[model samples]
Target: MIKFFKKRPPANLPDFWKTYENCFLEKQPEEVNSVRFVVLDTETTGFDYIHDRILSIGALNLINKHIAINQSLELYLIQDHYNAETAKIHGILKNGRGTECITEIEALKQFLAFVGNAVIIAHHTIFDINMINQALERHQLPKLLNKTLDTSTLYKKTLLTSNVFKKKDHYSLDDLAEKFDISMKDRHTAIGDAYITAIAFLKIWTRLKSKGPLKLKDLLKLGS
Candidate 1:
């Protein structure tokens, strides 16, 4: 049944995407400060484009520099395809740990409900976002409409582009986590990692803002 839907396109795409996209069409505040941002991640079976499947999704919402524990998206999916090779990095064993699994469609529905109208923030935004989009496509749903901000890009903004050191061409979750002293307690879990990313982003924003006024558009800066 799942295979029939894979990569084809989503059916009965929830109305949420339309509404979320509409938020963008409206006039955005000139000050880039008052926006809601969602940071998220996907645990996949493997790195293979064709073989890998999303095993889980973890995310947290950031509004006005606050992160509330009750408001997070942690979804475990039922995936027959599990990769032992990536287990060490993400730690989701086949039928071993983590919460009970939900179907891919169920997870997407819940994810949409949680993420509605908020700008998405993620580390390596494309992969995670695309993973979700592929799932949506399979369900016949359209792509996500929310604006996206990548922390890797935001982290780069903290660096000085003095034409020396090249300002670290790339930034990884591990790098930002270490720099900010954030514990990897919920390391392999989606929500735990999302929390880590959220905190790291805050620290980066603080440092950048100290230099001058900050705005939502400014934080959306993926590059220097």
Candidate 2:
């Protein structure tokens, strides 16, 4: 006789998560022009994913090179973990005034519903992705299943192969903003950075397409 182990049942995901996951059941857009790109940024208490918490999340959806202000998302999370040192950078007070903030669970629920099946883009994609994943884990939710793109990597591809300007190992959002002449009006704010990233992404796409025909698959390969 052989002993057999029973398969574990899947966790019962909430209706919002189910709806978000169901969006992926449909095939993703193949053409770059038709694809929806969500540029997101998270303002955390600190760099440590396990220790720090997301103070706020800002994201905007870009389609066919257009970013509509009305379609943007800005969620301020009620903070349980606070760091004074990092506060100088993000400028989010623990008891900040003028706006109402929601719990992490509430914010994540809305974020998932808003994101749907769009491809995610960020400057340093991994850090932001990890932060969001950790937040999900805290709420016993699954990690994001959407594909991600790093503008830093995409920006590098836009540069000439010639030895004239050696590509730096890393690029900051400010670097891209200055290079692209984008305004820094909302620097350090999640939505503001997402807007900058969205603009930079379109500029990068223009440069990439100038070389040859482009598709959604082509850019996915460059994602972090």
Question: Best-fitting candidate, measured by lDDT?
Answer: 2
Pairs of colliding residues, candidate 2: none
> TM-scores across all candidates?
0.84, 0.94
lDDT of 1 by residue, 13-76 (tens): 4676555556666654556567777888888887654557899999887877898678877889
RMSD of each: 5.9, 2.5
- How much is 214 displaced in model 2, in angstroms? 0.6
In each prediction, how many residue pairs overlap at the backbone (N, C-alpha, C within less than 3 A)? 11, 0
Worst 10 residues of 2 by lDDT: 6-15
lDDT of each: 0.78, 0.90
**Which residues of candidate 1, in runs, are more than 4 Å off?**
1-30, 162-166
Model 2 lDDT tens row, 95-212? 9746789999999999999999999999999999999999888877788989999999999988878768788989899999999999999989999999999999999999999988
| Total clashing pairs in model 2 | 0
Judging by TM-score against the true structure, name the best candidate: 2
Superposed on all Cα atoms, model 1 deviates from the true structure by an RMSD in Å of 5.9
